[model samples]
Target chain A: AQSVTQPDIHITVSEGASLELRCNYSYGATPYLFWYVQSPGQGLQLLLKYFSGDTLVQGIKGFEAEFKRSQSSFNLRKPSVHWSDAAEYFCAVRFSGTYKYIFGTGTRLKVLA
Target chain B: SQTIHQWPATLVQPVGSPLSLECTVEGTSNPNLYWYRQAAGRGLQLLFYSVGIGQISSEVPQNLSASRPQDRQFILSSKKLLLSDSGFYLCAWSPTSGHQETQYFGPGTRLLVL
Candidate 1:
């Protein structure tokens, strides 16, 4: 069985500060990893995804995630977060040869002034 | 360009009532469709998925059922709604060919069961 774990339930960061959301997954083979963001009362938007390539993958809205196979982690990061960046983040994993995505519990981001 | 649409942005239903939610995709053909539910403060739970019309696969066994009448239309239904069914339902589509697996999501429908 494949599963994703987001360690942080909630994270508060000041405007213009850097942000990092932790995510770990358990899978038997190389996994397809994705990061998605959801605003209040809105559907999720795909931020970035990693199929197979460079470890670091850039995504929309200046977001990026690095896939670390040895550690089974794919953490999302942003150099600077704006107030508008506040939202819920989720990490999802799909093992090769599978179409189903296993998602993490998600981390709520709160940007402060 | 491809887009996904889900109807009834918000819905309120009583327990034991029948439920129906519609999802449709545009600008794509032979795409894989999926139905997911997100409970309050929880991650997405995939309810069902379809590769083609009349080909539906359920990931979870619950009060809901799914149907695909057309290539782009998917429906979720329930004979009797339950309180646990109250959640945000999302419709997503992914290209089955080209080896692409990224699922694009719809605006979603929020359901409240009383």
Candidate 2:
């Protein structure tokens, strides 16, 4: 079964500092990956997605993720953090042509001002 | 652009009460619809998905059920609510056949079971 794992349960970063959130997937073949962010009491917003080509994918709000197949990881990164960036992040994986997506447990990001 | 909408931004219901959550998609047709639950501080748990009318696929067996009576409307219902059902319920739609396509999410409905 395809599944996703986010190692970090929570992370705290200072404003303007760089940020990185880790995500790992267990799948036999290449998988479609996505990153979503959710603010308090709000629905998830898609940050970015990786379907094919370009190991390094850019997303909204200055976020980017690199898909490292060998490592089974797609880690999200941002050059600088903002207070509004404090939210929950989720990593999702879906097999090609499949109808289902498996999501990680999520990582809570806290940005300090 | 396609947009998804879910109603009753927040709902409070007692255990054993019935539930009815509505989801609709606009500016799109023959889209795949999905219902997901997010526990506090946790990942999303896909509850059900529909590819077309009368075609419901359940990802997780729970106290909830879903139906697509119209091409653009999807509904999630439950005969009896449970405390475990309290969470953030999200409605999503995708242009392609299924999860292989990038999904667009609704604002979501927050349900609290007392």
Candidate 3:
């Protein structure tokens, strides 16, 4: 039973401000973690992913995430968010034995002017 | 380069009507295909997945079924549509031989059940 939880349902941040979205997962072993972003009425796009080794992972669109094993958390952070960054973010996990992905409830991001 | 395509960007069907959503992948072979449903303002829910042709694994039991007629073709069908089935349906594919796999999603099909 692997699952991911995103504590924030919605987050509003001003343009040029730092953004951090929280994500926690419950898995027995070292999990494969991913962060995806989806615009309204569009498919999801990969933001970043963590398999092993480095605790921090960088991805496209200037997005990054840190995998904290002790806290069971993989939070996404951006130094400066633009208006185009406003979208829904999802955290996903997958185990070694399966190909299916377990996704978090998702966090809606709103960029304020 | 690999790409995924799903047809009928948006669909509206009545209850008890049948469903047929097609998904195709290009520039890849023997990909692991998946069907996912997402409700408004919710996360993605895995409905089914396939490793090869004629092989389908269902993650959740519902009024939905999936089929892989070809190595790169996946289809989601239903004998009778349900209101709960109205949502955004996404088709995704990933490499079959990877430890840390990342799925690539199609443009997605929005379904509305009346």
The top-ranked prediction according to DockQ is: 3
Each prediction's DockQ against the real complex: 0.79, 0.74, 0.86
State each model's TM-score restricted to chain B.
0.98, 0.95, 0.96
lDDT of 3 by residue, A17-100 (tens): 999999999966668899999999999999999999989999999999999999999999999999999999999988777777
Clashing pairs in 3: none
lDDT values of the candidates?
Answer: 0.93, 0.92, 0.93
In candidate 2, residue B69 scores what lDDT? Answer: 95
* Cα error, candidate 3, residue B51 (Å): 1.3
Q: Candidate 2 lDDT, tens digit per residue, B1-114?
A: 778889999999999999999999999889989999988877899999998899999988889999999999999999999999999999998887544488778999999999
Give candidate 2 misplaced runs (Cα > 4 Å). Answer: B97-100
User: What 10-residue stretch in candidate 1 chain A is worst by lDDT?
Assistant: A93-102
lDDT of 1 by residue, A78-107 (tens): 999999999999999878777787889999
Candidates 1 and 2, the one with greater DockQ: 1
Instruction: State model 3's lDDT.
Output: 0.93
Residue ranges of candidate 1 with Cα displaced over 4 Å: none
lDDT of 1 by residue, B19-80 (tens): 99999999989999999999998889999999999999999999999999999999999999
